[model samples]
Target: MYQGIRIAGFGGQGVISAGILLAQAGVEDKKNASWLPSYGPEMRGGTANCSVVISDGEVYTPIVSAPDTVIIMNEPSLPKFEPLLKKGGLMIINSSLINSRPTRTDITVVCVPCNKIAEELGMDRIANLVALGAFIKKTGAVTLTSVEHAMKKVYKRAKPEMLELNKKALQAGYDAVK
Candidate 1:
């Protein structure tokens, strides 16, 4: 199986972190994975995105020009990445921040209230994790267990409570999808 994913959002929205976690999860699952990140000059509140490729065999490249799945975390990202999705791809939009909807009919769109769910979980920063959970549920690119295991490496300095909260956020996202 192979998945080319592009996750886009503002800088502080954990777009890069989410990509890292996904690639790490692939490693935890003993799969081939690569992550390439791009961002604007500003640190916070700037446009940020990452391309992640996960496959059971070798990964040909880290760049994903036409992604199988696109996770849009903000309003601007919707327009920026929507057209880059492969035909019949999946688009996971964070509806809490993005009010506009995609106009494309060739792809499937799943709108998740990522920020709303994260806030309900006690932190809005975990919205990316929530989105990740939805992606996992929809694509099965990697398992929840692998993602949790990957947190150890990606979020090396996280406290136990924070980890637990993250896990909860993921599960909530997963359950939210179906």
Candidate 2:
């Protein structure tokens, strides 16, 4: 199985981190994976995105021209990446930040109020994780168990409380879509 996923948002939104986690999860599941990140000169609030490719076999290239899935966390990322999605792809959009919706009918769109849901969970910064959770649930490209293991590795140095919070945020996002 091969899945190309793109995660886009403004800087400091954990777009790259989310992509990393996904790739790591793929690795944890013994799948071949690659991650490529891009961003503008401005760090925070600037356009940032990452492409992730996971497959049962080797991934020849990291570039993702047309992704099978895209997680858009902001308004600017919508127009920029929406057109890049493959036909019949899955789009998990953060409706709380992106007011507009995709016009395409060929693809499946799942709108989640990431920021609002994360805020309700008491950590707005985890909005990216929320989107990631939804994406995992919707696509099943990576199992939630694998993501949990990857999260542990990603936050290995962090405090236990923070790790628990992130896990909760992930579960919350997954539940939101279900």
Candidate 3:
């Protein structure tokens, strides 16, 4: 299996971190994966995005010119990345921030109130994980178990409580899809 995914949002939204976690989860699943991040110079509040490629075979390159899935975490990201999704691809939108919907009919769209869900889970920062959870549930690109295991690796400085909170956020997002 192969999935080329792009996750985008303004900085401080954890766009890059989400991509890293996804690639790490792919690694945990024993798959070939790569992650490439890009962000504006302004850092927080600036636009940020990352490309992630996970494959059962070889990962040809890290750059994802056309993604199989695009996770849009903010309003500005929707239009910027929506057109980059390949036909019949999946688009996960953070409905909590984006007020508009995609015009495309060829792709599958799943709208989740990421920020709201995260807030309910006790933190707004984990909204990216919430979107990631929805992505995992919809695409099954990587297992939820693998993602949970990967959290230990990605957030090495995180306390056990924080990790548990993140896991709860993920599970909530996963369950939200259905």
TM-score of each: 0.97, 0.96, 0.97
lDDT per residue as tens, model 1, 1-178 = 9999999998889999999999999999999999999965735676789999999999989999999999999998899999999999999999999999999999999999999999999999999999999999999999999999999899999999999999999999999997
| Cα lDDT tens digits for candidate 3, 1-178 | 9999999999889999999999999999999999999965736676689999999999989999899999999888888898999999999999999999999999999999999999998899999999999999999999999999999999999999999999999999999998
Indicate whether candidate 1 or candidate 2 has the larger TM-score: 1
Descending-lDDT candidate ranking? 1, 3, 2
Segments of candidate 3 deviating more than 4 angstroms: 42-44
Worst 10 residues of 2 by lDDT: 38-47
Which pairs clash in the backbone of model 1? none
Each model's lDDT: 0.95, 0.91, 0.94
> Better model by TM-score, 2 or 3?
3
Question: lDDT per residue, candidate 2, 25-96, as tens digits?
Answer: 999999999999987673567779999999998899999999999999989888899899999999999999
Higher-scoring candidate on lDDT, 1 or 3 = 1
TM-score of 2: 0.96
- Off-target runs (Cα >4 Å) in candidate 2 are 42-44
Question: Residue 134 lDDT in model 1?
Answer: 100
Model 1, runs deviating above 4 Å? 42-44
Alpha-carbon error at 113 in model 1, in Å? 0.2
